[model samples]
Target: MSELVEHVDERDRVLGVVERGEAERQHWPHRIATTICRDRAGRILVLRRSETHSRFPGYYDVMVGGAVDGGESYEEAAARELSEELGVREPVRFMFKFLCREGTSPVWFGVHEAVVTEPLIPDPGEIAWQGWLTEAELCEVVDQRLFVPGGRKALRRYLESGSGSGAGELGAE
Candidate 1:
């Protein structure tokens, strides 16, 4: 059985539950939880999507996340994605949320941050390469590489929010 997602409207009200693929194909708005992981040294954990990934193949992303499952809160989805993608079970600080209109379909993006204290074990199926990069280095890479569009927008918003201040900067956690 395929995964189900909560289909929402422009104001983020749940309309109904739909298959993830159907939601994407039909351009239905849905919720996605994205977590930006940073290590002790204040470096961002970046990863390249596997070549066989469905949405954006072989693209680099600063955030590790996915669609929010039906009946799940954004925070719940973020935590699940963090553990599933990077094998980390840390507390994620909720940053903010916005409707990402740059992608194929509009998605309410719940942006979050987490301090990773353990060794990262990236899932091979979702991530092809993984590394830690300082904010400066990440900026350079984001400019030179082909990044996922929604991720790029999310990073821009995160930086503009003035909360990208290095690691251990958990606010309101």
Candidate 2:
């Protein structure tokens, strides 16, 4: 079972601890993660969550992401999630960190960006569909409300930066 770290208010102050299941049921604020995957052409990868997920099921989101463990750093969680969800073996660079509070529970969100030069194998349980889009197309989705609220915010930040820093810093080719 997944474990969750608890927090307080919209600011994400630490409260106490709770099990992942309990936290989900109780709507406790916790840390959420997001990763941006860029192809050699600078297109970004996005995916649709499996319909089986309890929250935001079947919604389009970042390439890979998840909740952070109790003592995990944002960068570690982002890197771990990338490998876990997409079978990516390259190192992930840190980008921006933001908080998303649109849900019943607030989320301390970390945005990371990575450039992929190899093949990707997405986790079926976490991803139902995947595709690459230009910045304009991605922004259009955000405008049309195609992504979850937190994802929208994260994407906007990424686009505005003109860098995938929301995902991470790109390495030299």
Which candidate wins on lDDT?
1
Name the best candidate (by TM-score). Answer: 1
Candidate 1: tens digits of C-alpha lDDT, residues 1-173: 99899999999999999998888889899999999888888888888999998878999998999989999999999999999998889999899988887766889999999999988888899999999988777876786798988887777777767866632322221
**How do the residues 70-155 of candidate 2 rate in per-residue lDDT, one tens digit apiece?**
87777888888888888886677777877676754667787888898878888888888889887766655655545777776776
State how far residue 99 of model 1 sits from its true place (Å).
1.1
After superposition of all CA atoms, the RMSD between model 1 and the true structure is 4.4
Ten contiguous residues minimizing lDDT sum, candidate 2: 164-173
Which regions in candidate 2 have their CA more than 4 angstroms from the true location?
6-13, 164-173
Q: Please list the residue runs of candidate 1 whose C-alpha ends up more than 4 Å from where it truly belongs after superposition.
A: 166-173
Local accuracy by lDDT, each model: 0.87, 0.74
List TM-score per model, in order. Answer: 0.92, 0.84
lDDT of 2: 0.74
